[model samples]
Target: MLVKSIEKRVQELNGNLELSLDDIFYTVCQEYNLNAVVIEEALGCKCPFALIGFITTLKSADPGNYIQYKY
Candidate 1:
């Protein structure tokens, strides 16, 4: 549900340059009825880190947003 809300917000804000990262994050949280902590836990990060990762994911589906692998 949260993911869906995030997706929807992303779609809605995609063409709007006025919406800052904070605006997008807040909007997504509001749409999904989730708190920042929930998102942080889901993303396995803390405040700001989770936000960064979410932003990264929104901009591009980069695997780096999820996890990093070193080999």
Candidate 2:
């Protein structure tokens, strides 16, 4: 859900601005009509990207190496 949502959103953008995870989460949830309880159930820190949702791309380290990836 998050992957497709983020992809669609990125494609729609004019490329002037980037979206933070929170921004994506807020709007995507509204777009999908998801509530807080439902989001918590689906994510709830179950995965690394679970904070906002899931990320579709990883240019550096694997999922286990979040900080390295950030750097």
Model number with the top TM-score: 1
The number of clashing residue pairs in each candidate reads 0, 0
Which window of 10 residues has the lowest lDDT sum in candidate 2?
A: 62-71
Task: Give TM per candidate.
Answer: 0.44, 0.37
For model 2, how does the per-residue alpha-carbon lDDT over 1-71 read when each residue is reduced to its tens digit? 65665456644532426765555555554554445344545466332245334444432324343222222
Model 2, residue 38: distance off in Å is 2.2
Writing each residue's lDDT as its tens digit, candidate 1 over 14-60 gives 55889766666666655544465555666664433255446545544
In angstroms, the error of model 1 at 48 is: 11
Candidate 1 segments whose C-alpha is farther than 4 A from its true place: 37-71
RMSD of each: 10.4, 11.7
lDDT of 1 at 11: 65
